[model samples]
Target: MSPIRTIVLTLLALLAFAANSVLCRLALNAEQVNPADFTSIRLLSAAFILAIIIVIKDKSAIRHINQHGSYAGALFLFVYAAGFSYAYISLSTATGALILFAAVQFTMLFKGWLAGNKMGNQEYIGLLLSLLGFIYFVFPELEKPSIVGCLLMILAGIAWGMYSLNGAKSTKPLYDTASNFIRLTPIAIIGLIATYFYFGLHISYKGLLYTTASGALASGVGYTLWYQVLPKLKPSIAAVSQLSVPIWAALGGVLLVEEPIELHLAISAAIILGGILLVILAKNKH
Candidate 1:
């Protein structure tokens, strides 16, 4: 893909991530669906949509769904999903986001180091600038996270980090992501059973509407786009780039969710975006 196309797709994927948070909040806060059912339907809908997309892309893809993805990727995906759903129940968005973001970057950076990759001084500066900006952006809203909630969010971050690492190695991102989603079938079933026994199934058309959009657009397509970008990016770059997620999320929240925009958000955004640019452009010196 051309550089412009890659940038556009990356931005779109970020937007999808932001939209997901808004959508989930809308549905759950309205009591339209419980967390368990929401997680189940989100994965289920994404899987179905991705499967259709794959079939349309290539009729032969039917037999290829399980060809590209590994069990490890699927397990990581499940862990991320489960941890995210549960963590948000007890943790404030700022607190959860801070922990999750830090953990993801650290996990990916650690993995990159283990893989024999090295970062330049400029890259280190960029990473620190971006992280600091992200922390500042969310600082005012952050609350003390509960022990369990903090731990869950951290696990979610690690799971996502591993999933991204796996995707970075895929030759066929679309196929691999679709397969990962398809592989979630058993995990989704387990979630359904656990939720059924604990809270029962709560269904609503409105809730389904939100979940479906979240799955098909924000998740299925979004993740595929992200996977496509991963191969072109270093793990550190990819992780730092994700600091922009909350900036976009805050923007979307203001425009779509009617949340007020704060001055610090814009200030931090410049720092984060600038830091990302440096990270992307500065050559690795090691």
Candidate 2:
């Protein structure tokens, strides 16, 4: 692919991911679908679609699951997918994405520290700014943030960070991506079953459709695009690109669901995005 095509495709992939958040929020907040059910169906649908694609295009990808490093990937996937979906039942999409991404950033920072990478003053400042922004954004909704919900989002973010870092260490990115989903989908299915009995919620047609699109298009296809472009883009560029996700998701909420875009939300988003950019840019400079 040409340079322009790669960049365009990468942008499209990010858009798809942002749409995933929007779709999930729509299914839950508008359609009254259980978040757990939405998540499970999404994962299962994506797994099925990917299975078909792999079988047709690359049967060898399945063998990679038996390799030495596949388990960690699968574990991360299960934790992230389940927690992320469940959290959205109580949390706003914008708030959830901000918190989750914040956790991911911190995880990366700590990982760097553990690896003996020097942390600069600017990075510390950026972290503080971002954290303050996050607090501000979520403060209005704190009355009933649901302890379980917050914890689940945090855990999901950590799981995703671990998944990204681990995938970086793997020799076969495609195989790792595919195998992780295959392993993770069953766990997601189990959770859906448990949630049904525990919460006494039924799956609706709207939920199934939303989840399936999320799983197949966003999780499977979007991720494949991410893996393809990750090696090509600079880390700083990638980070900046992800900053667009929350903005896109917020806009999506406003447009699709008529969610209010409060002044504080805009302010908080500016702060978080500015801080994240500063940190990423500073790291790249060195």
Candidate 3:
């Protein structure tokens, strides 16, 4: 693919991912799908779809997971999917995306430090600004937000951060992305099943359809594209691009779910977007 095509495709992938968040929220809040059931079905469906694609396209991809790099990648994916699904039960889609991406940014920064990447002064300043914005956004939500939901989302973000960093480090990028899904599917399924038992929930046909679609399109295909793009993107660019997700998800909520857009949400959006833009600009200077 040409550079322009690659960039466009990457953006498209992000949009699809944002849509996934909206869909998950819709399924949980409207469709009455239990968060745990949704998570389990989505992951299992995604795994099945990807498995079929790999078998048809390249059976050799299966070997990639057994490589050392895949262990960390699979773990990250497992934790991320599980936590993310559980969080949506009580958290607003916009709030959840914002928090998750913000956490991911911090994780990436830590990864950079460990990798001996030199952090420019501007980067540090931008990071501080972004952190403040995140705190501002999350502070009010904590008073009445579900504790279980908040904890799950935070854990999910940590998992995703690790997944992205590991992907950056892996030598076998293609297989790592593909095989990571395959390897993590069984674990994700187990978690989902356990969640079902603990929560005492059942999946309806509508819930299954929505969750499965999210997994197949937004997650399964979307993540494959993401992993393909990750190796090519500068970490800072990747992180900043994710800032758009909250805005998009918020818009989605307003349009689809009719969620109220309070003054604080609007202000928080501006601050977070501004901080992310600053980070991107500062990184460009180097």
Using TM-score, give the best candidate's number: 2
Q: Write the per-residue lDDT of candidate 2 for residues 162-188, one digit (tens) a residue.
A: 876775555555555666678776677
Residue 171, model 2, lDDT: 55
Name the TM-score of candidate 2: 0.89
Candidate 2 Cα outliers beyond 4 Å, as residue runs: 60-65, 146-148, 170-172, 195-201
lDDT of 1 by residue, 1-286 (tens): 8888888888888778777766765566544577777788889988888889888888897786778888898889888877876776665443455456656766776676688877788878977897788677556645654567767878998998888888889888888888888899877878889988988887788878987887888888999999999888765467667876766666655666565655664686577666655665664433
What's the TM-score of each model vs. the native? Answer: 0.80, 0.89, 0.88
Off by over 4 Å in 1: 92-95, 116-147, 234-236, 257-286
Which one is best on lDDT? Answer: 3
Clashing residue pairs in all predictions, respectively, total: 0, 0, 0
TM-score of 3: 0.88
Candidate 3 residue lDDT tens string, 190-255: 877697678876777777777998988888888877777777887777877887888888889889
Task: Give the whole-model CA lDDT for all candidates, comma-separated.
Answer: 0.75, 0.76, 0.77
Q: How big is the RMSD of model 2?
A: 2.4
lDDT of 2 at 10: 83
Selected candidate, larger TM-score, 1 vs 3: 3
